[model samples]
Target: MDQAVLPLSPTEQETSLGSIVPPHTADAYWLTPYGAPGAWSTNTTYIVGHSWEGRASPFNNISSLSQPGDVLTVTTAEGPVHYKIDRVTTEYKDTLKDSAIWDKAPGRLVLITCFMEDLGGKNIIIQASPLPAA
Candidate 1:
């Protein structure tokens, strides 16, 4: 049977993994699908993303989050959050402000990382939406 072709939108994106800990607290990092493991917290710099081009640039766009086939977990002050891979892409340092990528969806988690230095300092973005309650 032929599959239905659906137009790709920024909402249908993938998720990325990230380690978030309470600021100015102790060595504590939030894990995915699970709470803080015993003493697993450290000044790990909350591994967000690396230099996409090994150059000085602001890594703060959610457009790349619209890529498909990516996964990520979000740990917020509320509790452990999970997201599935939907989309992935790389964008220039200038056009990062395009809110359409993020605003497309609500209560979604986005991961922005730096891709290898080359494609005009592009950023590796992973966008994911919240999973259903257990």
Candidate 2:
């Protein structure tokens, strides 16, 4: 919960080539060019990181976010934004871009990481929506 969210921007070359890879770091990365967290925009904000085996990383815990009502918060410069887990599903690495997680939605969040158990085959995707203020 105390993790940092670093901005990740694809290089112009990578962007032009249509290839983008998240950096190899333990911190969560906010995919730039999309709506930032807590924004009232028309794009889904994506936070991605690696899930390593035998290592205690925050992203490794993403696989446990299976319950629909679970909540997680992302702290931005403005403040904290809360999201409620809508669904958690996995997609093949080859077909991930075409998955439902890429849908354009206002105030939606999608956390992505490699599925450790099936590291080479699929990716773990945790989709959530902004939680209303109490």
TM-scores, all candidates, are 0.45, 0.87
Question: What is the lDDT of every predicted structure here?
Answer: 0.39, 0.79
lDDT of 1 by residue, 1-134 (tens): 11111111122121221122123321222213321211222211122333333344334333432446444454445655555656666665555555345343444545545555444455565555556645
TM-score, prediction 2: 0.87
Writing each residue's lDDT as its tens digit, candidate 2 over 3-108 gives 7888899788854553356886677888897778884757899888887788777788677746678988887767788899888888888777567676689899
In model 1, which regions exceed 4 Å deviation?
Answer: 1-48, 52-70, 102-104
Please state the error at residue 110 of candidate 2 in Å. Answer: 0.4
The weakest ten consecutive residues by lDDT in model 2 span 14-23
- Separate clash counts for every candidate: 22, 0
Please identify model 2 stretches exceeding 4 Å from their true place: 12-19
The lDDT, on a scale of 0 to 1, for candidate 1 is 0.39
Top of the candidates by lDDT: 2
